[model samples]
Target: MADVATTVAPLVRRLLGGALPVRLEAWDGSHAGPDVPRGAEALIDDAAAETGHLTIVVRSPDALRRMLFAPGELGMARAYVAGDIDIDGDIFALLDLRHRLGAAGDHVRVGPSLTDIGAVVGILRRLGALGRPLPAPEEEQRRRGRRHSRRRDASAVRHHYDVGNDFYDLVLGPALTYSCAYWGDGVDDLETAQRAKHELVCRKLGLAEGMRVLDVGCGWGSFVIHAARHHGVDAVGITLSPEQADGARARVAEAGLEDRVEIRLQDYRDVTDPPFDAVASVGMFEHVGAAEADTYAAAMAALLVPGGRLLNHAISRPDPHADAGIHARSFIGRYVFPDSALHEVGQVVSALQGAGLEVRDLESLREHYARTLRAWVANLQGDWARAQRLVGPGRARTWRLYMAGSAVAFEAHRISVHQVLAVRPHADGTSAFPATREWLARPLVADGTGGAVGG
Candidate 1:
């Protein structure tokens, strides 16, 4: 064991670009640089050199062995949650390394056919008779709880969005739009697609100069600031996180958009002003608990003018049963996001209809989200260390698992994201939009594959 550690430690250090301080000890022997706790049967130094600034202690090799070879992703993440493996440095860096190593076809390699065999085995194991029974109806009900629970709200949004902006900044291209990319004809790269997506929404609602727009669940206030600055719209954005609101305010002020955009840290229910000409809620609906769907729709309806339009971009599950047995709800509810619920496409349509909104357009963005997540995971892998300092080990692990799992889910067609454009019918029952597809198809700038910047 000591020999193996001695050999692997240097290799790992080389991979991490620095010398790592490690202590390896077996049952009857100890090789000391840093003290290995007494009674620690097997100890391997897995700590990287960059992590020296953190105050965390290293765990014994025995504990790490159990965690690394765990049967499921959940078990591996649970080890971090249980403090079985100590990451003395940035947890995000450690997690990024783990994710990159796991995805780099190194950790558990198999040929295509053998990989299929292993997947079959894993599926069977998850469905085995010895597995835990399904949650009882009452327990399932308790899982949803309430949207107003501060603890639940914090857990839900923080689990996904709070994974550090730098990590997202790497993979999300220059726009920093974390939602699905619009891959229409001639759109290839992430930045173009994201910009197209933004412009598409703006055009769909016919955003005009001096128009007042309410952006619900505005992430980073991207749409609000962009619309106000570039399109000459008056925009107000609302978010649940104080960090997001503060950051968005800074961004708005930096762009000299304080006159056109206002961001507030407030719940959607608190938005009581009426008669906004246009509204948008992008990548935010999933956090609205199932019970609050109607309330959410009504809030949007109340905020809109008589014939206002609303563009909603959200991820959707094919069915409620899709998430069963994946521990998705539990992990998302507990570690990552709380009080969040995914709706079926039908459910979204029904809710919009019930709120007296007429659906004008619908687009499936499953492939785009899958690609987006892949990009995000790559970005997260690149900047893991700094991210860990922002959150913690447990949180870092939770995000890695969540993003990877979501990527797999999208790839497998178990989940999807969508963009739905809807409108509150006019008193005369006619849409004010004048053929939106023409503007949507117009080229913003020429494709710049030659390393040239586009407009």
Candidate 2:
């Protein structure tokens, strides 16, 4: 009976079809998996390692104990968050392992073979991993109250956003825009791509001088200030996080755009002012649960005047059937976005149409989000000490895992994002729209410093 890497290696290899794509280093100073040549050996042993491709480290017996009790993602997530285990290499490799396991099919999930279970249990017993389930990390959150109720929604928002402005500033870059960026041709770097994204949104909404705009779930007033200062629009940005509202207001004041922009700590449902020229909900629609889709669509509709545009930019499930029976209640649901939900792009369009907003455009930015997330992960890892200092180790680990995992997920197309441009047509069934999309791609200064004049 050994708790060494050899014991753990065989089990994982058996589960993943007898060959581990990743190296495993167990708590007992033993290692297993592929024999790498020379320096490539470290290529993937560090989860945050840029050159690393595949390494999973069981730092303690508790890592296995946690997994033994919980199984699947949750247990693994807890082990990672608690520092019981560490990863080296590309997270995508883990996904690949799952793909291999899927070939094992029903045996893996529906009902694992009894012999297989017995083997795992026997190994765990030998490794001293069979025990009471460890407590979940304190960082894990499960929201209370009615789902999407204004109060509960606010809690969920704060849980994700209250992580501090400085920390977000570091991860999100100077743009401070937390959404899928436009990685258009020759557009490199996070800040530039993010500005391109905002500019693209402004154009899609047809923003111009004297127009009134609303930014729902505005993170920190970047969009509203951009709209008002550059596009000359009177903009109102609303958010559920008090910290975010304060940060946005402070930013607006700093920009001397106080007269043109307002940051309200309010939910979209509580907004009373209407007849705006356009509305923008970027990266925030996930919190609007599927059950509240109509309410969300109607609210956006109610906020726009006739002929005004609404750009609902959100991460969406690739298809309604794609996520069927798959649960979001895994690690992300319990930790990062407690009550979030993703709907299919078509379903989103249907909801908007149900509220009388004509769905105009749906462009997938799936790859762009992957790029954005990769940049963010790099930023966090680059300044990891600072990040850990700002948010503590557990939260820092959470963000690193969340952002990197998201980047890979986006690349895999397991999830997607879209910029949905819709319009509130006039009573006569008329709405203003350009005949071509050529104007939307006018190249701007990649750094967001000078140029890229807004209309």
Candidate 3:
């Protein structure tokens, strides 16, 4: 068998033949270059080079073959997920390298570039006939049946969320809120930012004492617990994940608000309870695919009473026509959020309007989401070893990469998170919302303890 050094040396040569912006280090202690044709020299990752910023570590020759065979982002992601390739520092900066790879598509008009073809041949020759190496079964998501079917959706949610609550606690901080947080000048911590986010949703919905609120896709009862405790409302939180439902019910009981909060392991389509005074769905909207946007809006509207408000907080795509083939098949879909879809904000508004809901207000919290993801990444990195022990390295890699890549995407405006406040208007066509958006400006009050969320 050829040694790791000889196998990676030629592969590194081919990578450098392009204008990659990082320095590559092989298992045998060989270095590539800081002499990138484009991008900052400081972004290069060389341990001995003082100017290096990022370093790509090639752990094995098979890892190199994985990239060479697949090519492009998916190939790179597979290597990362398989633990064959590792990025040592500033994984966010690796986005720059991805952009370069995307732009290099111009070089392959008809087929693979000469350098790419050569690298594949060289890596394969060294690695031998390793026929179609599959990612660790635990790493890849296997969903059956039609896309977005109820059973399949539940499976997808379970695959991602049923990784154990202890694992999520490490990544999501104390609040256990698995969504974008609302960060402000006063919000300095993850728990605090999450509190601000829940409170913001409550305030936007005009949640009040004795009101009935329904929280769709509620994870661990964060919003439902918050709403029932803080706003003195009867809140029902529903999720498809059995693990989440179990955790949420435990949390509701722990908060001693079991009477006011009901955590149901049910799907939104089957939720028969109607005439909720207010409704909130956070981080759940993205899971409702584009084809089902209208169905989702109509369902929520059917459960809401006239004059009741609904706040839909979800991620949105800037370009509706953008090809998300990479997202659908990459680590995100394979491990993180299988079959999830992000629709344009305008499409969301149209769907809501078509469902007889009035669009009251729309606000972009893109920057806040970026900040939230950065905090999650920090939490994950801080408890890196523990997280790996809890969910294993492959799953941990999924969260770290997904979070960092999403943060950079948010920062670049390639994607965004929006809080769309809408209301089921009365027969007289009145929304009953405050005349101005001033109501949302009020300072949110929380004990900062991550204690029983709401009041």
Candidate 4:
């Protein structure tokens, strides 16, 4: 057994590259690797060396055991939460590696499938953590003082989205959409589902050639370019992030739609456009605090013509109490996204109506968002180092926690994503639904198969 362990140690070292060192030992002293120093303990086979500066241990095999024979993602997440596995250098980096390796096709298949009741129970139990109250803030005055403002918003946003362009490029496919991909339930791949979501928004807005459209919080301006190039509408995109604004502008030029599409770095409140034919705010509602929901709705209503349509895509909770005990508000407000608050669908509807907009359509995108987050997590895991460099260690860890937590929330039915279509009434107080079918008839799917998910 000792001879066998000695031979396997060199093979393990070769697999991880010389940069990573390994020491292996059997449960009995009969077998041990040369690197295993005397008196050092043996770790389970599932463990992996993680830290760059130290030989940090990963309980991967143990985690896999819990996941395969018990719960899966939820189980692994709980192991981290409980400190069953220790990560030395960067927790986010370790998470990224786990996500990438676990999501690989073979590894994903190895887990007890979601259909397994035990696995589901384990996942639910882990997700139960999200319902627990947040830890009390430290006694330090500096930490308490830091929570009062939006100072961390910029850093938080950058931490999550500013991972290298190449990293995002690998996961998001051609459209580069970072928000929910509207899968039409039966859709097989993410790309088709995402394109369908884009088209669905365009259709709901009743977009026409030469009409003006405004997209608020437009990440990378995918919708702006899509509206102009595909729908023949002139589009303007507004975003608070300089990186997004610059990238969108470059993309617009590359698409030869520079004349038709405009991108700006501006806050939603400052948008003074008189009346656009259509307005869309995608994946940005969460940033508007509860105190700002009314203002946000009013801003959209004000920008649209009397008969104009507005499409708002946002993450929401089923009810106000969904995250009641979770301290989600404080966690996100401080460590993750500052001044961000998720609204319930009812709350959003009331705000829109109060702002004088009538609800035309409402769709729950819970499952779609679940799939989208899963894809994103997998992508981020594949580009761990690049992600770490783009956002510092702490920030990166915060994002991973947020994303993984969000996925669990969605899967457990604690949270949801929604697309609400609204219309500003005409002077006569009537809706203009005429010709709606024509717009809706266009092939939502690129391949002519209408089997896609969302709309």
Strongest candidate by lDDT: 2
TM-score for each predicted model, relative to the true structure: 0.67, 0.90, 0.88, 0.65
Which prediction has more favorable TM-score, 2 or 3?
Answer: 2
lDDT of 4 by residue, 43-149 (tens): 22333344333223333234323433333443443333333333444433333433323332111111234454343344334433113222222210112224213
Candidate ranking (lDDT, best to worst): 2, 3, 4, 1
Model 2 superposed RMSD (Cα):
4.3
Clashes per model (N, Cα, C within 3 A):
8, 15, 5, 8
Candidate 1 Cα misplacement greater than 4 A, ranges: 1-76, 80-174, 183-189, 320-329, 444-455
Each candidate: RMSD: 11.2, 4.3, 4.5, 11.9
Ranking by TM-score: 2, 3, 1, 4
lDDT measured at residue 393 in model 4 versus the true structure, 0 to 100: 44
Per-residue C-alpha lDDT of model 2 across residues 91-124, encoded as one tens digit per residue: 5456434454542111112112334566667777
Q: Which candidate is the best by TM-score?
A: 2
lDDT of each: 0.61, 0.78, 0.77, 0.62
- Report how far off residue 204 is in candidate 1 (Å): 1.8
Cα lDDT of model 1 by residue, 290-346, tens digit: 677888888887888877899988888777544312234244444555556678877
Residue 21 in model 1: shift from native, Å? 32
